[model samples]
Target: MSAIPVTIGRRAALSLDSTPVPAGSPLVDTHGRVHRDLRISLTDRCSLRCTYCMPEQGNEWLAKTSILTLDEIELIARVAAADGITTFRLTGGEPLLRTDIVEIVRRLAAIEGPDGRPVEIAMTTNGIRLPEVLPGLAAAGLGRLNISIDTLRRDRFHELTRRDRLEDVLEGIAAAAASGLRPLKLNAVAMRDVNDDELVDLVEFAIAHDAQMRFIEQMPLDAGHTWDRSRMVTQDEILGALAQRWELTPVPGRGGAPAARWTLDGGPHTVGVIASVTAPFCGDCDRLRLTADGQLRNCLFSTTEYDLLPILRGTSGEWEQDIDGMLRACVRGKLPGHAINDPSFLQPARGMNAIGG
Candidate 1:
């Protein structure tokens, strides 16, 4: 496969005389948000071509050599873990598509955090292949799972994903639940006049499956760049729809989590809304994304990307120190918010799949 040429509007320029990061320093940005979550994209390949993610064809993928090797991923993850990164969320076009995913999880799970505990490893997958991989992943210390399912209706699923694999997704969800992945999450992107009407149904399905449902407001992260604000469902609308079906009591203590959760009918079952477009949780954001091709992204909507592949593959003896300095530099440059609602806001060059979910 040929490497796709990415047009990065901003690139982090590494200085030769950059100061070394202080020992045991926490990854904190200018806004004082302590970074910990590391979302790593293992690949840009997916089994399904969802309308909101990418087109069916004409999309160039990264060459195998350009993609980070497992060894490289481990080295970067270890550095982050030592720097106080406690959570690792493995994401991708579909992480299950990686042939060595289980081993990747195992290597990551072995890395201890600053506090001397193994870092938490989670994954966001489309779940088509989860049924086959869930067992090995669970055994390899995969802590949590988030499965994306847009609609409950079979026809709608096909319409949205451009694939007829709703049955496989459901099976994957069932397997995940059976594998004892506690607090299993189901992610559904709520679109206006699309899957918006099924908000209640989605929640009900989640409750029945013993999983928490999260409705996400569609942002301008689609590969097509065709995201329309008018067509995107807002958080308030989702809550309002659920309110008609059941009373939703707000759940407290949502620190750094993208989802603002509420208990349905004041008990047990809960539903969350990740209103990335309307609510904008960048203030509490602690995420740092490593693209499949090894670019470090400070913010989801950031136009800037720090290329770490060169440093990782450099013949220089000070690669570790160089990486540490780059990590610090990346965090220091994080924007306060995604600014998607601002008039000057420009959507990122890469879409959600390439950026990781």
Candidate 2:
């Protein structure tokens, strides 16, 4: 196939970065699902070119000016907060790459949830630089940390992420623990014949570190778009592997949560498996994604995006009403599921990094 230039018509290419959020009711989709979780991507720039995430090269980077400003991010979040959204997760190509992130946290932490309680703020980072920034982040009101560590073996880590900073990642994990970021979570993407052999060891590492560990089934979010179901290590395989060494028991009430919890017999800590590819929980997925470019995605695999940038940037007198209406429409259009296992599934145009983790 020959490369073709793509362009959005002017009607769809407005910029919005200075709009304010007006008071509103909770954001509810057509299916009667209320939004409570928001994932915001800070930037699309990353330090590691994980094979499953970004390509080795030739990624058409978003123009720096096209990315949302911190103020813009804050305003969207504030509106979401007022709409009963209590949890916000910051993601990135690497969120820590943003220089103004701490200040961003400081501003967001000031927004109260609909319950009048402090909003729960969390982040997912590769952990290479956690040691240097964890303290600042913790003091700025970050409540949870999800560090991505796919392998304990240095060689395997290098093979997976195309980076040899395993030692730095380990140090960063320790720094996160020391900073008192409670309920630390570790994310490992399980790939067939790659790092599958290290699953149990990764869990044990998490147990020793007092962190909750989750093995995520690889999804079709890679920039390469070469995802094959046969290449993924599924949830059942993960459990069977864990059962070989540790007795496993399922935890109750796993609804809406991405990870299905399991108790490790004879151990105080637990482990989880996010079977997104095999057994998706999209029906109860209460999360929304705001891309770094200010597009609102109701579903992770949503083909369409609601652009809020132009509205936020424009001088329209009815910007708030426009935003509120757009939010309702996005929610109403949310698909019941991503339909990845079906033959008719359509891969998202952008990779996971661009979509927000």
Candidate 3:
């Protein structure tokens, strides 16, 4: 990909000078899930207040000053890539809400991958604001996109998002696909009595538009801490629903990826479902999240996080040593499952935005 003179205000480019990982430490987790993917949270700021993810009373966001600087985030990504992470994702409280995202993507593309190739950079957005920034992002080395579209009905979209712009979102998807973004991924959360009936239609839309649709099982996260199991729609139910129209079959894989792959009978296109709640994929979970506040989370449901910014701002040698040490230290403490399914479990202190969901 060619470099573009992309500029985003409020942040600056970071230089990567960290040495390669020592011989002993490997990036793969116990479940054979290598640290090939890194999701970095730029800020805990978003434009919408969804009921499932955001509180009705609104969330207490981290102060802007406390969030990781762009350079600091880039340093972490460099270290992470050394440990085998190549597929990097920029997330948010809506990453687009950040003041310097385009520049951030440009800087990330400069971070070399394990094999000296430019890493595959992507983002997950709500897509309402995508049209305005799609060209900038594509030119800045972003190759893939996953947009969250929970409902097709305008009123229902507002109910799910607590905002309006279904039209904007659709247009953004159209623009992204038309821009050669390649088989755009649509993220739809399957909520009982909410968008369940829209599953068939969602599949139709994906097929018609030549996009891959992924239905996510609503998990107990964010404002959904008090999750209504009655409101939950399991992957089994989703499969049953989709099976009505097409003869769905499994697409086997190494299983490190979260979504279980499936193809429609006699069709080339495929769809996926993330059974995070009913069928937890924690055992094979390979991903890790870096919060804007500089905490390294081993698991989404894991309560404790090891902070790394202080070391980064410290002496360069010690910072590199400490970051490498922290990466090694995090491996032993990683959790097999988030354990969010436990009714009595108190969620870790961070909100979805804080953790960069």
The most accurate candidate by TM-score is: 1
Per-residue accuracy of model 1 over 1-357 as CA lDDT, tens digit each: 012221111123233345444645788787899999999999999988988889988887889989998888887887788778899999998999899999999999998976789999999998999878888999999999999999999999888888999999999999988888888999999988889889989999999899999999988998889988899989999999999988999999999999999999887999999999888888899999999999999988889999998888876645556676778888888888988888999999898889988
Worst 10 residues of 1 by lDDT: 1-10
Q: Which residues of candidate 3, in runs, are more than 4 Å off? A: 1-25, 30-33, 341-344
The TM-score that candidate 1 achieves is 0.94
Better of 2 and 3 by lDDT: 2
**268-355 in candidate 3: lDDT tens per residue?**
9898999887778777777788888888887876788878877766654444446656765565567667776676667766667678
**TM-score winner between candidates 1 and 2:** 1
Taking all chains together, each candidate's TM-score versus the true structure is 0.94, 0.92, 0.89
How do these models rank on lDDT, best leading? 1, 2, 3
| Residue 187's lDDT in candidate 2 | 96
Reference-based lDDT, residue 86, model 2: 88
Which has the greatest lDDT? 1
